[model samples]
Target: MEALNLNVENTSSKKVTKLPPKISPKHKRINVLEEYKKRNDNKVALNLVVVGHVDAGKSTLMGHLLYLLGEVNEKTMKKYERDSSKIGKSSFAYAWILDETGEERARGITMDIAITKFETEHRRFTLLDAPGHRDFIPNMISGAAQADVAILVIDSTTGEFEAGFEANGQTKEHALLVRSLGVQQLVVAINKLDVVSWSQDRFNEIITKLSPFLNQAGFKKDKVIYIPCSGLTGENLLKRSQNILEWYSGPTLFQQIDKFEPPIRLLDKPFRLSVSDFFKGGISGMGGITVAGKIEAGTIQIGDDVLVIPGGEYGVIKGLEANDESSKWAAAGDSILMTLSGLDILQLKVGSILCSVSHPVPVTSYILAQIVVFDIKVPITKGFPVILHRQSLNEPAIITKLVTILDKSTGEIVKKNPRCLPKASSATVEIKLTNRPVPFETYKENKELGRIMLRKGGETIAAGIIINILSYNS
Candidate 1:
C-alpha cells in the first residue's frame, strides 16, 4: 500500500493528453465561471469551520444559529427538545441538531464533524461543526483544512475562560492550527456572555488577553474581531436584542460572517479536488458513486474526465452539486458533491486527489519542507516519528534528515545539520512517509494541498509547507 502505481503513465515522464468528450449540439462547452456568476446573483460562497475548547458550547451555538436562520425546521427542533428532555438534558436540544449520533448524545460531545449548508444575505456557506475535545484534534484538522474562515467560540462564564485559555486549552491550539492550515479570517465569538450579564469589561478582558497570542499565531490584528453573544438564548446571532447591552452596539454574528473576505479562487489552475467522503450510490438516481470534497484548484464540470491519483483509476463526472445546490460546474473554493462514473468502488480513498487526466498531481514518498516547531517538552531530532496530516490524509511519517536550521524571519540558514530542533525553532527537514506515497503539490504550485501538520502523541508538534518533492514515483 506504500507504493505508488507505476503502471500508469507518468505525467512527468510522458505527456498524457486528455481527450475531450464528444458533445451534442446543445451540450457545447459552457464557460463555467460565467455560468456560476449568473446563477448566484452577487452572493459569494465560502466554507466556515467552528472551533473552540471542550464544553464551549460550539454545537449548541451553531445549531441554534441554523434554526434561527430557518435551516432547521420548528417541528424538528421540537423533536430534539423532547428527546433531550427525556435524557434530562433539555439544555442540549439545539446541540442535538448537529450531534445526531446516539453516542454523541449520550456523551454530550461531538466526536466527528457535522456538515451543514446555509446562506446569509450576501454569502452562501458550508458550515463544518468541528469537534472541540483534544482527543479529536485530527478530525478537527480535517475540518479546518476545508474552511475559508473560522469562528472561535470561547466560553465567557467565570473560571471557564481561564480553564480553556490557559494550560493545554484548545482555544490557543485551534487558532494556531487554523492559521497554519491557511485560514486567514477569524471571528472570535465571546460565547455565553449573558452568563456574566453582558459585561463589556469581561469582553474586553478576553480580547485583551487573546490579542497577543492570536497575533503570534499569524492572524493579523484587523483580520480578527470579537463579538459578544449568548448561544443559549440566541442573542446577537441574527439580530441584536434591544436594551440588552446599552454600552455596546455592533453587527450580529451573521452580519460579521457576511463581511469575511473570500479568498481568490484558483480557477485558472489544473482541476484538483481532494476527496473527503464518498459513497456507493449516486445523487438523483444517477448510477455512479458520489464523492464529496472542496475543489482545491481549477474547475470541474459534467463530462470532464478525472483520474484518481495514487491508484490511477479513471472516472468521468456525471453529476455535480455545489454548496448543496445542483449545478452544471463547480470551481475552486466550492464544497462539491460530485457523481463519478467508470470507477471501481475499491479504488477511491478519502485522501486521494481527483485531477485532470493530463495534468495530474505528483505522487511522492519523500519531500523537503520548512517547518516551524511548536512548544513541546522534548526537542525534535532525526528519525522523529510523526503522523503527517494533509487535508483528510494521515500517514505515518518520520523526519529522515535534518538539513538546516533557519532564522525564523530571514529564512537564512543559521546552522547546517543541527543535532535537534528545539521548541519554537524553524528548520528545513526531509520527511519520508512510512505508509504510502500520496498525491501532493509544492507550496508554490497549490497552497491548499501544500500545507501540512505533524502530530505526535495526540499533539500537533509542527506545521510546514512542502518545499520540494525529492523523488516522484515513476
Candidate 2:
C-alpha cells in the first residue's frame, strides 16, 4: 500500500500530478494532503559524490541509484546495454549524464566533472560522478571540491580497499582528497554484490578492512552505511525492502541517502564573514556568502571602518543587501552585495573575509597543516614552497620543518624527527608563514578555516592544518 499521512498544508500547488488513468489501490487510498505534501516538501539535499578506484563501479552504482529512484526509465537501461557493447561497459550512463567529449567516453574515464540531477523517494539528489583514474584524478579533486557528501563505490571482488589490485586502478588518494576537500560524511557502496553471490562474508571483509581508515577519516562507524547490492540487479535501492536478508535491518541505501544531512556551519559568532564568489559592484562594493560566521559586537554599517587583514587593506561599507532586498544587518550565510566606503574596486576581491580589527586573531607566523603527501610521487622536504589556502585565501609558504609525518591512513606520527613526507602519507607539521595575518582555525574546532593545501609545480602535494606557531622573543 502507498504510504499514507495527513498534512494540513495544501500541496496541490507543488505537485504536477499526471499519472495514468488506472491507479494502484494504494495510490487511491493516500491522504491527498499528506501524500502531496510529502511529495512537495522541499527536500533536504546533499551533494553526493560517487568516487573510488576506477571501474570500482562508480558509474554503475550511480546508474543503479538513478534506476532505483526511477529517475531513469527502462528505455534508458536498455540504451545503457546497447551502448555498453560500443563503449565497453555501462559507462554510457556516465557518458550520458557527464556529457563527456567523444574521446572521454571512448576512453571510459572522466576527464572532467560530470554533473547530473536525479530524485529519490524522499530526497532530491545531485550526483557528481567523478573520474576515478590517477592521471585524471585532479578532475575528480575538482569535483569533490564541490561535493557536500561523498559515496565511495568499491568492488568487493577487486579486494584492495584503498589501494587496488587492478593495474591503472584508483587509490585511497581519492578518498583522502574527498576528506581534504571538507566532505563531512561518507557512504561506502559495495557494488556488484551479486558477483560475490550475496555473500555477507565478503561484505564484512571489506568493511573490516576499511574500518581503520574510515575511523581515521573521523567518520562514525554508523556513518559508513554499507549497501550489499548488485548495481546490475538493482536490489534494495529505492524500495524499503523489509525482508531482504534479515541479518541487515537498518534503512536501505535509499532511505539512508535521503536521511543523510549535509554539513553546514552554524554562524555562532557575530560577523564571521567568508567571501564567496566576489566581484566589482560599481566603484563601491563587493559581494559573496554569509557563508557561516556572523557579524556582531562591532557595529558595521555604511561608512563603517572595515579592515581586511587578508590583504592588509582597509575599506568602508558603503552598503549591504541580503540577496536582492536591502538588509539592515547582514549575518552569516546571507549572500549579500555591499558597497565600499573608500577602497577601490580592485582592493576587495574573492575569498576575502570581512571582520572587525580584533575579531579573529590574525597571526604573522602560524603552524598550518594537512593530511600531507596525498598522491605525492616525490618526497615533501623542508624549505619547499608550500601553497596554503583556507576559506578564500591561497598563498605560498616555505616549509620551515617537516616536524612529523602522520599516517594519512591513520593519524599516527611516523616520525618525530623527520625531513621529508613520503608517498601516500599524512603528517602534523609545524610551519612558519611566509606572509603574516592569515586567518586560520585549530582543526579540532572549525575545519573550514583550519586546513590548507601544500602545492608545488602546479600539483597539490600535501595538505594539513594550522597548529600554533613557535613565537620568537628577544
Candidate number of the best TM-score: 1
lDDT of 1 by residue, 127-225 (tens): 999999999999999999999999999999999988998888888888889998998899999999989999999999999999998887778899998
Pick the lDDT winner: 1
TM-score of 1: 0.94
- Tens digit per residue, CA lDDT, model 2, 200-244: 888898888777876664566766677776565666655434454
Give the RMSD in angstroms, all C-alphas superposed, for model 1. Answer: 4.8
Model 2: worst 10 consecutive residues (lDDT sum)? 1-10
lDDT (Cα, 0-100) at 367 in candidate 1: 89
Error of 1 at 13 (Å): 8.5
